[model samples]
Target: MSHSLSMPASCRASLRTSFAMSGALVATALLLPLTAHADQQSSETPAASGETASYDTTDESPRSAYLSDWYNQNVTVIGSKDIRFGPQKIDDIYLEYEFFGRKGPLDLYGYIDMPKFFGIGNAADSGAFDGGSPIFAEIKPRLSLNELSGRDLSLGPISEWYLAANWIYDWGHNSDNRQNTLYTGLGTDIDTGSPLGMSFNFYGKYQWENYGAENENSWDGYRAQLEYNYPLASFDNGASLFYAGFTNYDFGSDLGDGDSTRTNEAVVATNAFVYSFTHLRFLAVARYFHNGGQWNDGSELNFGDGDFRVRSTGWGYYLGVGWQF
Candidate 1:
């Protein structure tokens, strides 16, 4: 019981809502599918060659063609799904989504995994266009429920079509406490050439206690960077490839004794490689991070404003994994 109050109200509400809704949605979705077979069985579906039938059965008719087309033309639908998230990166859908297009089956096709890499062709090379530098478009719907994580609703056509974009403003009864956030940004991927993929992104990121964390913790900062990493035949199976990004960080106030680490810069360097396991479907990213900061972790540093103190340097490594559905 002591631990209950320590958790924010938003967390509790989300928990209860998810528990109730998840079960209901799953049951309703599964129920409709189960009755499909029974309906077909009760229909005038053609009987086996040797069996007697109750309804007229004709071939080469419009009705027959319709049913045949419905059955034969495969409906390959990779559905929009609900994924539950937890604290650990294992459940961080945003991070996973960010990297999924590269390793997933639609791999290199459905996702743009590179930026500023000329490994693939542009829209003009597809022969679908007869002019200089053909322009293309693609649109997608971004959906999420609840008032806290994002806007109650957002539907707009972004300028870049091959990629979908969003501007999320979430609020709720307990919103400003933990997740008092205001952010706007765009994200999307483009075709590099053909099999090669490219992803481009631009966003101004900031956070206020990230609705799920403790009340006083907040994240307010702006970061701008680009990432370029793809298959490099210059190396073995793209091993020992390089990905570099430079972005700045400006921490916010109202942190309640939290470090006033703002107006600082961070440079990103990673030498990553991939391992394929046909036995078990999983993609792992082994990245070494060289974080360049004026003040880093485990360093003797000082905050320069009126001798207010802070540390501004750090270096570390992180492991991220992606598994097939």
Candidate 2:
């Protein structure tokens, strides 16, 4: 268990909330489709005179268009360490259900995870079935401005713009530990001209029920996030390797309430390597935290047994295996 520092904020006592969605590991695939049936082959028909005639189906329309344009779902088993939630550093194994895709003009990503569900964790952890937060989930959705407006809004390297939103929830036992947060703002994808893919988002945060922190029920902060991905290699057996990562900067918060141990800014960056096939996937991530969860690094706190230095700035890691469906 983490030692507590002096604070009037109940959140600092046992904060377990996590920014799960911002750390989503999925990378979007960009498909530039010009004409829908451009790849279809022409069919041959026998004529009355026994000659063959060929006809193209390019003029034909799709029999049906699905509301969910494209999607992928997976169940992942993840082992993570030193994921800061406040003053505490969490280490646990979790089961997660993650999904991402596009539907009409909306792009989406989401996940629901059960922390410590397998009964493996540090002393600070509580199993999902053993009084811990039963579920933690985050959902992110972005509406495409170009698709909605029926116009080419592309400007040079920027391919698209979006109205984006992110929502997070942790189902703790009571109000004191539960967290609800929402971020809304703008997002955009950039065309890098090579194999690299990139996206950026800026958001204003709305805090709610944040473990009784002083910033709860208020607009407390802003976050800027950048995501990137590139394909590394491919195999003849249909397996592929890739690199993906994201960086998040959170600032402008009053959660510290004047405490030096807590601050208004935090930074988290992740680097991931993935190997994926038709039905199986594996990934490893190295994530760095600076003032993680806004808890100041190198700050001294008394865990009731004297003074201990907080190591909020460090590297954390995650290893996961998943099955795609």
Tell me the tens digit of each residue's lDDT in model 2 across 1-325: 1100000000100010101112254321100000111112123333222322121223463221212224545677878787665566778888777665455676666677788989998876775678878887777778889999999999998887888887778888989878888999988777778756567788999988877667889999999977765557654444556566677799988866678888898987766676655446677777777988788888888857777778888887777787654
Q: Write the per-residue lDDT of candidate 1 for residues 199-264, one digit (tens) a residue.
A: 333444445444343322334444432222233222222111212121222233232234333223
Clashing pairs in 2: none
Span of ten consecutive residues with least summed lDDT in model 2? 4-13
Once superposed on the true structure, which residue ranges of model 1 sit more than 4 Å away at CA? 1-183, 188-196, 210-221, 232-262, 269-271, 278-314, 319-323
The Cα error of candidate 2 at residue 2, in Å, is: 17
Q: Please identify model 2 stretches exceeding 4 Å from their true place.
A: 1-23, 26-69, 302-307
Query: What TM-score does each of the candidates earn?
Result: 0.32, 0.79
- Residue 125's C-alpha lDDT in candidate 2? 77
lDDT of 2: 0.60
